[model samples]
Target: MRILLTGSAGFVGSHLVERFLGEGHEVVGVDNYLSGQRRNTELFLRHPRFRFVEADVSAGLPVEGTFDAVLHFASPASPPHYQQHPVETLLVGAQGTQHALELARRDGATFMLASTSEVYGDPLVHPQPEDYWGHVNPAGLRSCYDEAKRYAEALTMAYHRHHGVDTRIIRIFNTYGPRMRADDGRVVTNFVNQALRGEPLTVYGEGLQTRSFQYVDDLVEGIIRLLGVSYHGPVNLGNPDEYTILDFAEIIRDLIDPRLGIVYEPMPADDPRQRRPDITLARELLGWEPRVPLREGLERTVASFREVGEGRPERVGVDA
Candidate 1:
């Protein structure tokens, strides 16, 4: 299949490109590099079945071709990137999504959206389910990302229902692995980088805030399965294993350097107090569940970070 994938230079998007190319699919990747790295696209520049286009999907997709699948993964995902480019975040979720959907409609192709767990926004529900209406703040510090994904999901459904476009929406949980930007301000990269440098790991607030981390490979697998399945509604794709910020910090410290200390700092506003995806829907529908353990995934991630020597102590965003 020939696939049109936006945000192909992103951490997760790059992984998807590898998988898709390996499976003998022709992929046309698009990215604006707002948060994605150009190095990622370089990994596939020589691939026979891959092509990369440098353009922002928010304005338009410049590629001209009828694709079998259109996966919309563009947008600044991390707090720093989205907060820094708040308007771009909103535009991508609004205009970028519309552009992708329109292209998919034009080609009569399958459409898949990469939505985030931020939509839950300090979820009141203990373990969030697909049926739960999220507790998101429409106007808040994190609203740029949270509301954008929420609106994107709504738009995806609207396109699916009204236009009969084949659509899939996967609510991605806290995914981390190699290719993650060290300066992205996410907790995983921050802790890993700081630990590698033998610096005190920064833990926001009491470090009681919980999050479910999903390895990128596992997430890519779930995405592949969802694409093959017939489900049209949103499905949670993440690991069920939960960990507090403090405990996660300890794990990273142990992996990198056991002597690294943990330091508490002020929590960011609208940070989710808890997040654990109820993947029961994913399990029953797609027969998918995260396979990589946290420690193992962290080991691989640390190896990648160490190889590149990427580390810096900065304000960490706990929202995954």
Candidate 2:
């Protein structure tokens, strides 16, 4: 199959590119490098099955060939990063998605939108089911990411509804693995970096905020299953195992360097107090469920971090 992948240089996109190529598919990857790293997909540049285009998905994306599938994974995902470019983030979710859907429609290709768990903002429900309408704040600092994803989901379903365009939506949970930006301000990266550097792990609020972590490999496998399934879905693709923020930090500490302690700080605005996915729908619908355990995932993540030194990144700040 010939594939077109947006955000193909991102942490997740790069992995997807490799996964597809490994399956003997020809892939054309497009990225703007705004949040994605060129080095992430650098190794695949020489592969005969891989082609890359440098362009921002929001402004415009022009591809020369028809594809068997189009995976739209563009958009800044982290809170600090997306908050820094709120307008671009929103545009990528809306306009970028529209462009992909149009391409899918024209070529009769499968379209997969990489939706996020952020759509369920500050979720009131304990374990978010796929049917649950989210509780999101429209005016919070995180709204750029949260609302944009909600709009993206709406756009995905709208495309499925109005045009009968074949579309798949995977609501991803917290995923971490190799190639993740060391200073991306996400919990797994932050805690792992701190532990490696012997710095204090930073804990937000009372550190009781619970979240589920999915290894990138597991997340990608679930994504492929959901996209390949015959039925359209706004399906939940995440690990259901839950842990508090502080507990997660401790687990990282124990895995990397047990002697390291933590530093407490106030939680960021619009940060969800809890998050866990109900995958009953995915299991019944797509036969997909996460198999990676949190500790095992952390061990692999720690090894990756060790391989890639935690160098100082350009100071990018958000109003969170």
Candidate 3:
């Protein structure tokens, strides 16, 4: 299969790109750098099955041919990056989706948008289902990524409904793994990086907010499965093992470096109090569920970071 993957240099995308290449698929990677790191995709540069393009996804993307799959994973998904460049973030969410949808329409290929669980902004629901119409605050600090993804889903469905383009959306939950930007400021990376550096882990809002951290490998598998499945619209792809911010911090401290301690700080405005995906739909439709446990995943992530190390924190839009 010839797969066109945006955000290929990102933490998750690079892992996905590797998986696709390993499966013997022809892969074309596109990244604008933004929050994505070149080192993440560095290993794929020489692979005969892989090709790369350094272009902003929102800038009227160019394409060569029909692809078997179109995985739209571009856009600054974390807080720092999206907030730093809000307009560019929104444009990628809008234009990137349009460009991918258009390409899918023209090529008759399957289109899948890597939507975020952040769509369920500070969700009121316990275990958010696909049918839930999220409680996002359009004017909040988190709005850039949340609303952007919300609208991206809208555009994707619009293309599917009106233009007959094959489309699918996966609401990815908090995922973390190797090659994650140490300074990305996500809870996982922030905690891990701080631990690796033997510093206090920053705990926002009394460290009470919760999230189900899925490993990147599980997420990549779910993405591949969702792409091949016949589902339309969105599906929740994340681990259901919710953990409190403090508990997560403790785990990382214990695993990576015991010297790391926690420090309380104000939770950012509009931060979700809790997030746990109801993967029932994913199981039924894609026959998939996360296999890696949080402990194991964290171990793998810590080991990876130890080897490569986070040089300095690069501000990235915090993601789900």
Candidate 4:
């Protein structure tokens, strides 16, 4: 299949591009490099089956192609990155999503949206399932990303229902692995970088805010399965394992240097108190569940950071 993938230079997008190419698919990658790293695409620059286009999806796709699939992974996924460019985040979610849907409609192709777990927003329901109506602040500091994704999901469903576009929505949970920007400000990269540098790990608030971390490979596999099936879903794709920020910090510290100390800071506004996906639907529908343990995933992520060298830390944001 020939796939048109937005944000293909991002951490997850880059990995997805490699996965598709490895599976003998032709992939056209589009990115503006807003928060995505160009170096992530360096390896694939010469791949015969891969083509890269530098463009922002918010304005338009600006490419002509009839693709078998349209994967809309564009957006500032991390809190810091999105918050830094709130308008761009909103535009990408709204306009960019609309453009992708139209492209899929034009080509009569399958459409996959990379939605985030942030839509759950300090969720009142534990182990959030696909049916849970999230408790989100439409005008909070994090709303730039939260509401944008909510709107994107609504738009995706509208396109599916009104226009009969084949659509798939996978609410991605916290994912980490190779190609993540060192200063991306997500918890995994932040902790791993600090631990590697022998610096005190920064923990927000009481450091008890929890999150579910999934390996990128697991997420990519879940996405591929969803695309192959006829399920018009908003499936949760993430590990069911849960960990508090403080516990996660210690785990990374121990992994890098058992003696590293931690410093607690106030938690950011609207930070989710807990996050654990109920992946029963994914298992039942797609026969998918995360396979990488947190310890092992962190080790792999840390190894990548080591190879790349610790990038300068940017302002911390809400934990993914």
Best by TM-score: 1
- At residue 47, candidate 3 shows an lDDT of 93
lDDT of 1: 0.89
How do all models score by TM-score?
A: 0.93, 0.92, 0.92, 0.92
User: Model 2: per-residue lDDT, tens digit, 1-320?
Assistant: 99999999888998898899899999999988878887766869999989999888887778898988999999898877897899999899999999988899999899999998888887889799988899888998788888888998888889888989889988888788877877677788888877888898999899887777888998888877776777776888888887888988998999877888888988787564467889898889877788878888888888877766653332221221
In terms of lDDT, which candidate is strongest? 1
Q: What is the C-alpha RMSD of each candidate to the true structure, in Å?
A: 3.4, 2.8, 3.0, 3.2
Model 4: per-residue Cα lDDT over 1-320, one tens digit each: 99999999888999999999999999999998888777766779999999998899999998876999999999888777888899999999999999999999999999999998888988888889999989888988889999999999999999999999999999999889988877677788888888888899999888876777899999999998999889886999999887888888988898889988899888777554467899999999989989988888888887777777653433222321
Better of 1 and 4 by lDDT: 1
Candidate 3, 195-295: lDDT as tens digits: 87778888888776677789999998888887776889699999998788898899999986677668888877756447789999999988999999888
Model 1 lDDT per residue over 257-314, tens place: 8987898889877564468899999999988899998889999998888876657422
Instruction: Report clash pairs, candidate 4.
Output: 205-265, 205-266, 205-267
Evaluate all candidate structures by whole-model CA lDDT and list the values in order.
0.89, 0.84, 0.84, 0.87
Give the lDDT of residue 5 in candidate 4: 96
Ranking by lDDT: 1, 4, 3, 2
Model 4: CA > 4 A from native: 204-209, 264-273, 311-320
State residue 117's C-alpha deviation in candidate 1, in Å: 1.2
